[model samples]
Each structure stands twice: as C-alpha cells, then as structure tokens.
Target: MASSNNQQPSPNTHHNPLFDEFRWVIQIRHSLEEDHDDDIGIPVSIFNVPKPLQLSKPEAYVPQLIALGPYHHWRPELYEMERYKLAAARRTQKHFHSIKLPQLVEQFTKLEHKIRAHYHRYLDFSGETLSWMMAVDASFLREFLQVYAVEEEEEGKALRRLSSRMSHLVDYTGRKSAHNVILRDIMMLENQLPLFLLRKIMELQCSSTDAADEKLAKMVTSLLKELSPFKLMENFPCIDVTQHAHLLELLYCVIVPQSDEQTEDNEIEEQNDDAGAPKEGRQSYGNSGHVKQLFNSVWNVGSTLNGAPVRFIRGIIVSRPVKFVVQLPWKILTGLPGFSILKQPVEYVFSLQGGQENTKVSNPLDASVSRPPLVEEIMIPSVTELISSGVKFSPTNGDLTTIAFDVKTVTFHLPTVSLDVNSDVILRNLVAYEASAAMGPLVFTRYTELMNGIIDTEEDVRLLRERGVVLNRMKSDAQVAKLWNGMSRSVRLTRVPFLDKAIEDANKYHDGRWRVKTGRFMKRYVFGSWQVLTFVAAILLLLLTGLQAFCSVYTCSRWFGGVMNNVQKQN
Candidate 1:
C-alpha cells in the first residue's frame, strides 16, 4: 500500500474514513509471503485483550494524515482497496443525494453521539476501565462490532432494509470452530463451524433468561461461542465471586455503588477560563450552505516577554465514545490552564500600569523587568512529596506500592461541540516529528512543552545552542490567512517571484464555493403526477391553442360585418 499510488497520509489528516486500511494492507501483504495455516487460531484472550494500534472503518476512526497532493505510484494489490473505497464513496453519494446538507449533518451527529459512549468504559463499569484508558486496544471490541456488519443503505428509492452490518462483526467475535482453540479456530478460515461451536458454548454458560439486557446477553454470547468458554475452563480457572462470597461480600456490593457515586461527585470539576490562556476557534456546518467558523477568540500568547505574536496549535480527540463512557484527551488539556494537583505557585508579581507602589498579583510567574523572567516550571508532587510534606504515611516501600498516584486526575467542564468537527480546529491531530528528536524553534518549543513536559536546563547542554535554530524556522508566507476570521482588517503585500498571491486567491475561491443538489418523491400528487417538466410544457401548449382560436374568431366577425354593410349600401 505504501507504493507511490498509495502514499502515506500526512500525519495530521486523521479525518480518514478508514483507519484500519493500513492494518488490513499489512495483513494481506503478510498473507502473500507466509503460508496460510488453515489450522491457525484466532487469539481470544478476553482478560488479556490487545492494545488498539489503529482506527476502524465506518465512522469509528478518523484518518489523521493531512492531504498533500496527487499521489504517485501504486501497488497492484492496492487496486483492490481502491475499488472498495470507490464503492463506499458511491454509496455515500447516493444515500446523501436526497438528504439536504443540514439533514446529513444531523444524521452524522446522531451516529457520533451513539458511538461516543462506547469509546469509554462505562462510568458504571468497574474501575478497570480507567486503568486501561491509555493502554488497552479497545478497538478490538469496536472492530469486532463494525467490520463484519453490513452498513444500512437505501439507494435510488429502492425500499430495502437489511440487518445492521455491525452484527456480523459481533457474531464473528463469538465464533468457536475449535473447542480448545477458540479464536485460533475462528480466524483460521471462512467457515461456519467455528461460529456454531461458539454459540453452543455460550448457551451452556447463561440461559436467555439470565441475561441482564439484550446487549449484555449478546456480549456474553459472543464471548462464549468464539472462545469456547466451556473448554477454556479446563485450562483457565474463573473466580465466580458471586458463588463464593459471604455476608461481608454482600455488604461490600451494597456499599460499592454508593462509593462510586461519591467518588464521581469529587472527581469531576469545572474550571473557569484563565485570563491569560489562549482561546481557539470551533467550526460547524450551518443552514443554507453557511459555516460557523470561530477564529481568533482567545488570548495573546507570544514569545520572549512581549515578542511578536506567534501561532500555536491546541489538540484533537483520537477516540469516539460508546455506552456512557467518554475518555477526554490528556494532550489537549495539558496546555489548558487549570488547577493542576501537581503544580505549585512559583511566585506572584504585579503589573505596573502607572503606579510606582509595589503591588503583589497572582500571575503564576513573574514577568517584571527587575526579576529574571520566571523560568516556567511545572511542579509534580509525587506520593513522596505528599509524605515529605508530612501528610502522614508510614508504610514500607513494597507495602505502599499498590497506590498508583502517578496519575493525577483533573476534571473540567467540556463545552458542547458537534460530532463532525471538533472545537479546536487549529490543533492538527497527528504528530510528524519523532518525540526523540530535539525540540523545534522558540514558539513551537514552548507550545510542545506545554503539551509534553518542561525541558531540563541542568542536564541538557543543547538548550544554549538552539536560539538561532529556532529563529530561522519562522514562517514567511501569509499563512496568517488561516488564522483570523472573516471580520479582520486588511493588509497589503507586494507579490514576489515563484510564490504569488494567485495560489491564495484560487484557494480562497475553492474554499468559499458552494453547490447544492436536492431530490424528493411525494406519496401522491393531487395535481395528478404530470411531472413538473411535463406540466410546464402542457401549459405552454394550451396558451398557444387559445391564441390560435382567438385569431380565427376575430377574423370571422370582421368579415361578416363588412358583408352586411355592403348589402345596406346597395339597397
């Protein structure tokens, strides 16, 4: 797929419709070289689920690769993939042909909301979801639901309704071709035996009556049929707490949900925006082909104390939710100003307006001329810090190791945003530079540091040598147009060689152009189904017929009158 024709996408263009395309290409390519073992098993270790490496198809994962230009070169195998994409695109064009742009946006919004909950572990689910927030391949479950299922479609007004395409994925996950070899058997070949075997096993575990809900039952059923839960019991022991727990266990169950409720109350908190923190724009499609694009609404962040203003990106979400859970991105929130449980107040300084009196203000870091610019430091107080500060803990090292306090949770109110585009459009979703490489120029360095972590001045000697390197990377073009909204004041620039304003002008036209198409089929036309085009033609014909009749009648009346007048004159 990496052939010239299927070029790798720019890291930021994650709006990709197919995140799993890359992985599928890899698997298919490997299949070419390796022998297909008909006996090879699908790995179905539910407790040991794999980590997600890529986004899935449908609306599940966005492609982060930025659009460059026409791609060169193509692998012969990629032709097959291209065909699949074409079919999908054609399907979308047809379904959306009858729906207006606004209605299309609303449909997408509903789908996004339904899946957003699934992206996270249910807040009601056991605490296990939180621990795997960053680690597990939650996409395993997502793909298991989406890939095998057929997408619903209604093209060209042909009234056909099929079951959800997602069900196939769910069904595939539960297939059990081999008794002991669960997933290994199912993934081996395209046979129905594996599916049959898995279903039998689930039937043994929980009766239909025992299921909590239809969905919960399906989840259990899929797991049972695919993995051979009955066979796996021989090698793997399952601890059924419901069977072994005593009175204390029953008491704990009653207390746990209440404790969960209390924890949630304390966990989520909303912080008002800081006066100094930069604000970004949001984009959404609106009525009549209009777009509401918010731009340049936040703060004035610059380099050196008052250096020229700079451009910076915020962050983008990587996952959508399912069920009732939502996993907010940590990278986006890192730069946002809030109560960092780990941060300490470095110092406060007063901004002098016209006063000579020394004043104390909470600026977080002092920026006055008298004091050296406050080295912006992010203080992280570990459990050790808490203990050192005499918060009272006396356990030995190994005894206290169970506490995973390295992660500090901060909750804030997230604004209501639609599903298509995110609130922070400037924050491109992909990272091209390797985290191992040295940091970039000044403005970018600070921006990255805000998302990552502070630089260590003591250990790193390269910090002193990067001033010129950073300055040389400044953007030269008028990409500033990408920043401000439609209301900004104008500026004049002398056009130059090679790089002209023509490109910008053409881009402006393309970006602003709008085209609309619509179609509808009414149940019955009281006007009697003379198609609109045919009706208009009939009206034109009727008008011509009336004009002809009027001319004939006028000619006869004048001829008769002249004849009578001649007879009277003769008499």
Candidate 2:
C-alpha cells in the first residue's frame, strides 16, 4: 500500500524470515536447474568406491601416493604430493612452447561442467577450483605416464630426460618402490582422472590431432603392458584408447578382450573340424566329441542283432518257465560234491558272455541315455589336492580363454600369472572397477575367485610356483597364499561358462579316481556323521546299562522264562 499513501512503513516490513527463505529457495532452484542442464547427456563413469568394498581392504582402494580426482582431493594425507604435482605441471608447461599453463587452465575451466559429469558423486568445489585441480592432475598424470610411452628411436633421447624431481619420484626402469606405489595409486578406482581431460592436454602439447591420438594410444598400451599381471600375447587385439572412460577402463579392456558370439561359434567349429567330428554331432559334444563317438561304436553290434532269431531267443529268455529252468541247473550244479568251484566259474563265464548280448540290446533304453546333471558351482580341488589326486597343472602361454582341462590325460591348463607386491592392489582395483562399470559377465573377478579357490595353503602356492603357473615375486609362498585369501573375502559368487566347465571337468576326473571316491565315501558316511553316531551309541549304551541294572535288582531271566512258558501253554 506504499505505507498508506505517504505514511512511512516499518523497516521490518520486508524482513520476514519466511519471505527470505522463499527467495533463497528460488535461487537454489535456479542453481539446480543450471546443474541439471550441465548433466543432461553426460554419463557418469567414475565412482567413489562403495563403503562396503572399502571396509575389507581400505588401503587397496584408497590412493597412497597422490589424489587424481575430486573424490580424495581434500585428504590431508595426500597434500604432501601437491608440491610434486605442481612441479610436474611446470615441466608439462615447458613442452607446450606456445600454450602456457594459464591457457591450459582456461581450457579446463571451459570444460568444468563436462568434467563434473564424469564423477558419480557430487563435487562441491567451485568451477575455478575444480578446473585448476583437473589441470594440475592431468599435467601430473601426463608427466608420470611419459615414462611408459613407447618412444621411437628419434624421440627416445628426449623422452628419457625427465625432470630431476620426477626422476626421484618415478623411475624410468620402474625399480624404485616409490615409483611402484605411485603406479598403484594411478590404477586406483577413486584416484582416476577422466581420459578426455588427458586427451585434451595431449592434443594441446602435440602438433596435430592425429599425432596426439597416436601418441596417447601408444602411451596407454605401453602402460597397460607394464602394469598387467597377465603377459599379453603377440596377437592381442588393439584397443581404442579414446573410447574408454579412464586408464583403468583401458587396462580392463586389454586384460579381458570382448569376443563376439559369432567369433566364439567359429572357434568352436574350427576346433571340432580339427578333431574330425561330424557337423551333426558338433553341437552335442564338446572338444572330446570325436572320442565319445569312437567309444559309442563298441556297442553298435547290438543294433545289427535285431533279426527274427535274435528276437526269438530274447523272447524265450524272458519267459518265466525259462528263468525257473535256468535257476534249477545252477542250484543242482552247486549242490553236487566237488562241483561248487566249477559251478561259480561256469556261471561267471556264461553270465559274462550272455550279459553283454542282453545289456547291449537295452542300451538305448538305459538310464545312461539321460543327460547328466548340471554343475552349478566351480568346485575344483586345491593345487596340492589336485597334484595328490594325480591331476597335472601346466601353465599356458595364452589368455584366460586358454584355460582347459584334458580328461584323458588328467591335465589342467592355466594361464601364467606374475605376482608382485603391487599385484594384489592392481587386482583389487580391477575387480572394483569391473563391479562398478561392467555390463556383462565379471570374467576377471571369476578368474580371481578361481585362483583363490585353488590356493588354500602355502604348499598350494609352492606347487604352482614349481610348475611355473604362478611367478611369485613376493617374500614367500605364505605371502602369496595370504594375498589370494584376503582378496576372496569380499568376492561374490559368479559363473563364467568356460571357466565353470573346466572346473566341472576337473572335478569329474578327480572324483573318478578310486582313492578319491573312497575318501569321499569315508568323509560323507564316517566323519560327517560322527557326532550323530556317537549320540546314538551313547543312547544304546545307556539302555543296555539300564537293562543290566534291572536284571541285577529283579530276575529278568525268570521273567522271560515265565513269558515263554505262558506262550507255549496258550499254543
């Protein structure tokens, strides 16, 4: 009312707290709208490690040397690395002769919204602060990753000349412990920088776009090969570095190459062709299908015995009168003096020769015609147990796809794995990354679980090392055992068809042995139920004691005699 057309209003008129809050909410709404606009089409690839995953081995997931992204950027413990990061940023600036550090930061500021969208968690830093952080982190990462770059002969000299500060921190030869620790930090789930930012930095440093792409790809590939536990084969597929989210994702792609279903079908077909299996039987049996067909031919004669004479003999043998007559001869032969030994031999020979002819006729209708039960879990024996059970362990110079179990030779083929102090950290982070990002099967996680299952004790590690399947760079076999055991604590059960099939084959082979069968029977019947059997025995002993005590007090013999006499009199 303008204070009633001239009268002054109180100063508190517009000072209502409720009104102030409403305006503040409007401001917040606009800010959120802006944020939503920035995140419209961007997909989040980086994630803060879940608390449950961190709780098992917090050090493995947390960066020990440097903080790469916003997730752990403010941790006081990692603040010491800030000076080094700044030094590396300065060194990186020298490489871009025309583009200065400030210009690089400006470019990052322009991409701030895009950078924020990559992280799953909310970033509380202002645009300027976040941009500066990305610039510095990307610079530091670029400098460190230079050591792993595949340098050409012309550029090798220039690439080898790292700054004095970085030289102490990152050894070109990767012999220093500090260097290894930084490498581990770079591979952590939380300490990941977006690959786009790295690409932008590389593009700015290089002469042209194609050169930057080529250099980045080479650097990433070399880094993966250096850090990977599995030795990459010569024919390993090339990975598109730009397509990945970060270094960790690129490394995962290198380790677990995605093969299409059609390719797998083709490989199976090729293997069947190598084994000379018929096309019609190819799908039913696996690698050993040809061998099964060969064994199946042993009973094929039964099919040829389907004539009238064979049918008449079968009908006569099935008659009840024939069965009675057959039993009379054996009974009479066994009853004769000095003919009992001959009776068993004659009966055994006749049964052996006749049983085959009868059994083969019914083979088509036998229970063997039914499909075997499915193996739900991968339940292979430990390394030591397999060796003791006469199952052989051999290292294959191929990828995870090369894991095979030969039934005839009782051999288990596994890929060679090189282990070191940082191997556990690398493996744990890969597993965590896969859990967060994978849309298909967790093949790497399944592989880790397989190793954990087969390595129960130090002796198992020793046996694997002896066979060159596990290259142990740790202090002892016990350390290797402990590392695998600790990794399996948070692992969830998963099934990879090929790995599971290999495990099933190994278990079947192990179970088929007489010693293993005997041991299983003893464990299932004797040791497994010892407590219940003991309780039943105690109850029986107690009842017997009570009966003896009653006999001591009252004459039980007389009681039984009187009952018997009464029964006889009644009869």
Candidate 3:
C-alpha cells in the first residue's frame, strides 16, 4: 500500500514560475558581477523625458524619423528606419576589412551590461538583442554624422557616394530635407547612442585609437557647429570625449563649459564696479586731501542749486494732499455714467507702480530689519519694456557667459543667436538634457529662460532682430516669438547669479529714470485709490446738491445775517 501511494505523481511536477524568475535574477546578478570590475562610473545619461516636459513638447524629446536606442527601437512607426540602419551597418562593415557585422555585434554583446547601465530605464531585451540594436544604431549614427564631418576623409566621401539609399538622407543641399529631420531625431534625448560604442566603431575603421579619436572629435565639433544656434568659437575648448556619456552631453559641455571656481556673485560685483564707477586711482592724489574736500564742497553746493527746483516740484507732485486733489476730478468723472469704461485701463496703468514705494529709513539697522527677504525669482521686464525705459540692446560675438549690462552706455549685451526651424528642437532638447542630467548649473536652461522673459511678443522679437541680437531665419517674427514663449513651460525656475545680476542692473537703470519714477508715483498714490476717492467724491457731490437745494428754497444768507445781528446786540 505504501509503494502504491509513493508511485502517485507529485502535484508540483510541472514547471514553477517562481523558479524561472529566480534563475533570471541569478543570471542578471552574475552579469552585473562580471562587469563590476570594468565599470567606468557612467551615470544613467539617457532618461525618459519627465512627464511635465514631455507633455509640453512631445515632439522635441521623442524621435520623429528614427529611433536609435532601445528606448524607442521597438515602436512600429520607427521600425521603418530599420532597413536603412541595416544598410548603414553593412556599409560600415565593408569599411573595415578585418571586422564583420557579426564581429561588431559580439563585441557589443560582451559590453552589454556596461551599456545598459548608461540608461536610466530598465531594458527588457536580452543581451544579444541589445547588442545587435546598439551595433546597428551606432553604425547608422556614425554614417549620418560623417556627413557633417569638418574634414571629409576618403572613407567618408566614398561611403557618401557608394550608398544610394543613404544619399537622400545625408544630402545637405536643401534647408528642408529628410537629412534635417534625422538630425533633429539624433539630438533627441531618448534617441542617443553611447559615445563609447561610436568610438569603438570608428576605431575599427581607423588605423589607430588616436586617429579614431581625432576624426570623432572633428565630426562632433562640425555637427555641433552646424546644429548649434550659437556660433562656435575658432578655438573652442578641447573636451575629453570619454568623460561624457553621449553626444548631447558632449555638446552641452562645449556650449556651457564648466565655470571656474570663482563664484558668479563675485564676478558680477567686479563687473558692476568696473562698468559703473570711476577708476580708484582717478579719485586719489598724492597729498590732495584739502583740495578733495574743497572740490566736494563746491560739487555739493552746485548739485543742490541745480537739483533744488526739480526736487521741489517732484515733492509737490508726489505729496499725498496734492495727489488727492489731482485724483479728485478723475475719481468724480469715473463715477459718472459712460465714464465707467475708463476705470479698468486707469487701474491697470496704476497697478504697474504698486512696488515702487519708498521703504528706506534713516537707520540702516531698522531698514535691514524691516526689509523683506529677497526673492530668488528673476523679474526683469520684457525687451520692449526695457527699450522704452531707455535701455539699449546690443548684440555680442561672445558666448553665454559674456552677457553683460554696460551701465555707462545703458546697453544690454547679449550673445547673438540664429533662429530657424531647427532652433526650437535644438534649444528644447538642450534644456531637456540639462534638466535631466542635474548638471552643476543649468547655464543653457537659464539662458533660454532669460530669452523667454525678454521676448513676450512679436514686437520684442522684431526689436531683438533689428538690434542683431537675434538672427531670425524663420518666416515671421510671430513664429520666433511663439518658439521662445513655448519653451518657458518646461523650464524649472533657476537663478544663475551672473545673468541675474545683468537683469538686476538693467532693471535698476530702467527704474531709476525720472519718467518711470513719476509714473510709479502717480499709479501708487493717485490712480491706485480710485474706488475710495470715487466714493468720497460721490458723497461730496450729494452734500453739495443738498446745500444748493436748501439755498434755492430758503434765504440762507439772510437767516445767518439776522442771527449774527441778534448775537451782536446781546453782546
């Protein structure tokens, strides 16, 4: 009986799903251990664009024509580019006599775990699948980027002419072409290939590692120069390619190079002092203390004489009693029928002066204690507003770090930027990459935000364009304005102290103008209290009307005359 019971089939004889999961985990652990020694400390550079940013401009972050990495490699829409990618791989293999496509794939497979670590998201594909995808994508990318290579080698020229299928895609003849779309795709954050893979592929074709790296650098520089909106300098800083995770990162390093250890605040202070104040030596003389005191006394006397009348008039105008008298008529008119329509426009004009009140005190300590905490937000006016406030705009040949405000000239110096159809995609992707990487300071992102703040409408764009600060290749000023305005949605609020200082100086210069101050005073004291003033005016009008009615009905003057006569007789 016991033998018969043992012979029965066990209930757990079939395969258990848990065992399969356990084996998979073990395999992954082993792979990780094997590659742990070879880890290059590459962070997850490739990221799915954050949902907020993606929702704002999905086209900027997602691949439109082709997908390079495994993130979007499986999308059916991008799969159509697979055949061309394979062709590129085939042509790339032909360049190297010693290595075949399968050999490249095998090399990539060996480094699969290391490659996977570069991506933030988990790749669901097997090791072999990821290797093949990377190899093909790297080959395609290398072939495409060669079109923009600064120095065209025999291999690049031959490859360009040999592949008829790739000719249309690499043709740089027209402004509008499939080539441009592919260029945009490659710049997308999700559609990036590992730079190491590209270097490996290039190394296979070149004579030596040094030759491969040289060609790769030239190719990347040329690509950046072509795609970057800002002009690249003749002696652009040389960057180590291996340190960067991908092409976008390499491009960012070139554009917003890591700043020095010197803090931005200190640099700004130095610039402000240099631009605004006279040199220290000019104010000093070898034994001239008495002469200095005499000069200062004379200067103070002359200044007082020159400014006394102007200050007296300003004081009278800004005085509360005078403001009330000036506003009384307008307030009364506003309450009348058909005059109510002017109220909103009047209020709006006045609202602009809300923050211009004088808060300074005689005591510095009291002022400091009572002063509001400084807000980190940047609140500079628009370009048109700045220009209207007597601030001038000037285009500069320098980079982003060169932006400055010339206090003497009252000029806002900005780096010249060329705008075209591709500008939007390039700028958006750069900002997206910066946001994702969490790099030290988002210099480029802050630059875009600065532009967005300054350009509020087509008028601002036109002004910038006319000033040569903006080179608009787009069809209309409206489009350029729209492009910049749309970008403000995805950017995080950040304070780049240097840029902020430039803005601060410009605002101070603008606000210091007499016209601006007067306008703010009018808005704050006169127009800002329209409602209360209107109510008072209405009540006064009612009391006057009653007085007139009483006088018309009775002889009020005769009644007061008789009362005065009676009082005089009693006295």
* Clash totals for all candidate models: 42, 0, 0
Error of 1 at 36 (Å): 46
Deviation from native of the Cα of residue 413 in model 2, angstroms: 1.5
**Model 3 ranges off by over 4 Å:** 1-29, 32-35, 150-160, 174-176, 232-234, 262-378, 490-492, 520-529, 535-571
RMSD of 2: 16.0
lDDT of 3 by residue, 394-419 (tens): 98876788798999999999988988
Where in model 1 is the C-alpha error above 4 Å? Answer: 1-201, 204-262, 272-571
lDDT of 2 by residue, 1-571 (tens): 8668568766667765534566556656755776456558677788877665678789999899799988888899998899999998988888885889889889887787788888888775467788899999999998888777835563557445666766678876778999999999999988999998888988988899778888888888888888788863556567676788899877788777575642322111112232343312212212212222222343364446764435544666558875554445445644665444334333332322332355542221122113221212134589888889999989987778888888888899998888888899899988888777766556787787788889989999999999989989899999999998777332333346677678767765665566876686556544676654565577799978877886698776664677788899999
Error of 3 at 469 (Å): 0.5
lDDT of each: 0.24, 0.72, 0.72
| Best model per TM-score | 3
Q: Is candidate 1 or candidate 3 better by lDDT?
A: 3
Q: Which of the numbered candidates is closest to the native, going by highest lDDT? A: 3
TM-score of 1: 0.16
